[model samples]
Target chain A: MIARLLMSLTAVLIVASVLWRDPAAPVAQPHPRFVKLDKHGNPLSPWQGPWSCVLDTTQQLVWEVKTDSENIHDGYWTYSWYLSGDPRTSDRARGEANLGDCYFETSRCDTQDLINRTRQAALCGLTQWRLPSAQELSSLVQAPARPGHAHIAQDFFPHMKHGDYWSADHSQPLSGHYRRFKQGALAVNFHTGKQYSLPYRNAAFVLLVADLPSEHHSSRTSGVTHQPTTGN
Target chain B: MRKATFVFLHMLTIVLVICSLFTGLRFSLLTQDWLKFLSALLPQGNLYFWHIGSASLLSALAAGYLLLSLWRPYRSSPSHYHLWVNRFGYLIILGLLSSGWLLWLGRFVAIAQPLHFYSLWLLLIYLLMHGWAYFIQHGKYVLSALLPKQPDKHSIAAVISVTAGGLLLYSAAQHSAETLTVASLAPEEFIEIDGLGDESHWQRAPVYTIETHGGINFDDGRSTIQVQALANSQESYFLVRWTDSSMSTNHLPLLKTQAGWKIQQNGFYEFDERTFYEDKLAVMLSHSCEVGADNTAQLGNRPLDGKPPNWHGKGFHASMDGKIRDLWHWKAVRTNDMYLADDNFFGPPAIAQQGQRRYTAGYQPDGKESGAYVMNWQWYKPGLVTPKRLPDQSNAHLSVLPWFGSTPYTAENDDFAPGSTLSSILYRSNRFEGDRADVRARGTWDNGVWTLELVRKHYTGSEHDVPLTNGTCMWFSAFDHAQVGHTRHMRPAILRYPL
Candidate 1:
């Protein structure tokens, strides 16, 4: 009987103690697994060197870093959803062209114009820059509780606007019918963490991404990809 | 029968007292940061009605006990010590009940608020003393002695009747009192829209001043706003005045750097820009008079599901229940020159749109006519930005630059010296039209105080506006040069049109 009484008292004290614990206590939070890369795509420390790109170790993808300078990668420039080519390859209707505003020499400021300029410039010593897929782009959104106004990581992506960004995904039909899927493309609003399909002529911001080759794939835990010294 | 009555009454008192204490302390914690630890343990969200309801029940219980004791006085307690303990508990309860009732009735609140707060501590001491005295006398079976066993049917009926009476009284009190009456006054002359409240007829209108707290750049994060409303047959006029140390009119001015022009800001990256923002005031009108923004303010970072967390961990304001609340936003730099308040509303969460920078949840502006103001930048970057327009002449330091007086920006014409600042607000038109220009307002800052005058039609006929009718609940907030950070008050000052 005495043993049972002692157990009951201990159980009550434990419950009370747990209830009284301070909610503000700092529990261990998972650190972001990212590798910063310089202009020529060289790995650098989290606190050192001017970086032009970020490598998400978890997703094993190379993402472009927008800038404030008057260049093709200027963050303020906006582009409409347009690609002048065959409709079958795009999985949707050929979007309207020359409807966006940019710092490029060509009057056409559509998504295809940005892609051509980025490839010719070979930013981050790679020529494979393209608009990211919806799932791939959304992976960059930091956990909801993280600090900063924009949903993405501010340290990796500087000059980040609170506007919607265009994704490569479009409102395509489920079957192989390409003609029926001519409505619009998908865009992600980082301000509210929401996705919506915008019309083909609607202007939005863009962020490019590239795939790492199989030979260049680093360890899964810390996949930091360093480019060769020779320019691409 | 006596034992059963005593047990039932004591048990009822315990439950009502606990409910009142928790709900009351939660409200007191708003300004009393020292009692913050008690917040995690107390009930959250809309505690005002619960506090009032429990007080009504407690009052009914106390009155019932008094009548019963008068009819048949209690036998003398076996112990003299227990008798004195019971008397001390009664004294503490009396203090709590009297102060609480005075606060609920909104009479002598200055003294009653503190009296009611301190009485809870005395109640805690009384509970400890009473429990200890009973435990010493009754030994191990103190619990069994207090528990009522097989109470007669008459006693049960009495308990039910007393509870029903308390609930009925609470429902009646909810409908009456706590309304601020806006008297109808005939102005001797035309009321000018100037920011001066010095009209002779303004003196006849009654003034309601509320002390709002918790915002940056205020006097200890607190400021008292004085509001007076007057209505002719056609239009309703309002005069609001508040104290602000500095006249913050320097909005996000662009500073020319050697690299280029960069928008001047401190925390705009985090959407909590305190410096270089405009001084503003906001007024919200809602049909329901519930506290905490009609329970629309959801606290915590990620309060709403499937929605991004707020930049600041404080909270977000979204009308989840689909009720529309009209908001009038007046900015010193953006709208002061136009002599109009930007009409806005809080409705259901908006569908996210492309190219939109900020997703303001349920807060959105009412539809406007063609002409409006826009930021004077081709694109905004924290590091550098290219201006959309340049000053036509030498006057480049104005807070708002007119579109007709400026030339389009060109590299060759960019002759401004480095470190020079330019205004960012580019006015396309004089003022807003349509439903967005419903309220005509003007404000003047003099000697550390702002006097603002506003006037609108009695019924705007727009779906976005709430008609100036009787019992229209209104709330006022002030921003001292901070964006999205405004001082707030708990209780709304309801509007009453003179019959």
Candidate 2:
């Protein structure tokens, strides 16, 4: 009986040890600035690399850009959230596709389907979101060697995949010219047909940006006060 | 104890044989030339026989050892023989895998050779076997551990084995650095010549030496020549000596011509005459070659009419003039009546000329002319003339409008009429005035195809008629073979408008 009791105690101790081994230790929490997500959502692995949310002032839109070496092209690409529900429904902010704007056309956005998607996002109070320009996307790349810029948020957008991301910038149609930012190397994509894209309703990732004030010329004698604002 | 000793020795022998086989093969591959020389000393077919014999012996030993290890009935006992074999085998496999992969991937991928693929397969198999053995022994707990864990006795052994295996593998891969012989040529090195009969050993003495440093270091020296050649032999001989400084003069040579001070050189000539402190010296030479009756170098019926022919043996005379301070500053002027060989004909062969009252400037192929004459000396520097000046500092007027093709005009007077058209204007300032003077002009082409004219206004309050000097003006024209005549003669007069 003593042996049985000791065995039982040992078994219980083993189970307790396994279960108590820090649940929160390896699983890091997302930064507070990031948008809240459902419980089932899992953040990117921490081992990946740096990630940022870039916000375009002209379009008032935000995008989640990730940078890592594991990507096929050794660059960064945008990732959009994939939510569940009617893609056009006001409450359906999920299931958005992560499409790259390698070859942009006004006709694609003006189609009935995209129009419906935009209307739904607007009705859902997502009026401030739109595609980012090529320049806006390139600004998010943080130079690892030089760290005067913003620090990479550690927890939420880790394991950022390195690949080509879509920018609203377009060249002549059929001529494959697109912008791609890979670890801060902004290059134009010559192959339009291979561009990737994501839907808007998805909860991928995004970067936010605000323009700083411009310097005033000393020659101007007028004592007019200047206010800084986000430039397009 | 005897059985155990035999087992250990057997395993050791197997490992040594395998290692030696790979090592020998790799050594033969790497030292191909050495091996070839050695083989020559042996009987013709004996080299192949010897290779087969050694390989067979090594394989038999390894097979025998393996068989002995497996023959043991008691599997539970930790045989020292088995342990040693496993340890050594693990190292050999790891080393071979890594070194082979690196070499094959780096060198053989571009060639797309069959041997590269075969070697790659062999390496992959070794890696897989090693991985399988590792997982089977460690179980899940240890398997989950990250690579390159802390070095203990097992890991230390692994490290050592891997290092040894790497060296052996590298040797077997047949990779070796190339050997090259290097020698330097200095300024003092003399080149000797032999067997030329009478002028047999004419010495070449380098005069001035120009050494290019930094990017690509090379020394090139020039020397004055004294020739001595055999009458029969086509080859000529000359003696050369090195001098310290350049011998070029920075002044145009005054030629005594029948046309009274007219600049004339037989074929082509170039000269630089400038008073600037650091003015470059100029040199010029000219030559002329005959072309076929077709007005072209008929080597292949190539265009010879004012165009450089694209063939061999057609001689071209080139005269270079410039300051001899540096080898890079030397400029050459080439002229050849042999058709396309000297086809760049927009103006006279002379680059720049100076006269007492009037100077005839040479024109570039791009229709821009530059020359200076005694125009009432105001400030010495010539002022520029353009159609319009932009506030943003953008030089939009610099672009040559096609309508003003080689027309003569002046800008001093508001002369828009045909005879009184301003071809060009000279800028001048009175001695009493502190301000400088400028000139400008404007006009249009007659045909719908060409229009837009301009002129300059001088501060001297003097008006010069357009096209008065030699019926030529500084204008812009395109280089089209078909439109050469029409383009050259269409120079319009410059009209001056009020500023």
- Identify the leading candidate in terms of DockQ: 1
Lowest summed lDDT across 10 adjacent residues in model 2 chain B is found at B331-340
Tens digit per residue, CA lDDT, model 1, A100-124: 8886756758888888887787766
DockQ (0 to 1) for model 1: 0.06
TM-score of each: 0.61, 0.16
How does candidate 1 score on lDDT? 0.73
- Report the lDDT tens digits of candidate 1 across residue range B1-499: 2767777777888889889887777666544547655545666544556776887788888888888788875565556776887888888888888987665554555566567778888887887678755655555577786676788775686588679878887766554435666767665557899999888878877888776655568766556688998888888899999878889998989999898898998767546678999999999888887654665665443446655444443445767888888889999999999999898888776643211334456777786644578777764555677787888765686889887788778889999999988888888789987788999999999988889999999799877788888888888888988887787765677888877
Give the docking tier of candidate 2. Answer: incorrect
Off by over 4 Å in 2: A1-61, A64-116, A122-125, A131-135, A140-232, B1-499
Which one is best on lDDT?
Answer: 1
Q: In candidate 2 chain A, what residue range of length 10 has the lowest lDDT sum?
A: A223-232
Query: What is the Cα root-mean-square deviation between model 1 and the actual structure?
Result: 9.8
Q: Second chain of candidate 1: TM-score?
A: 0.72
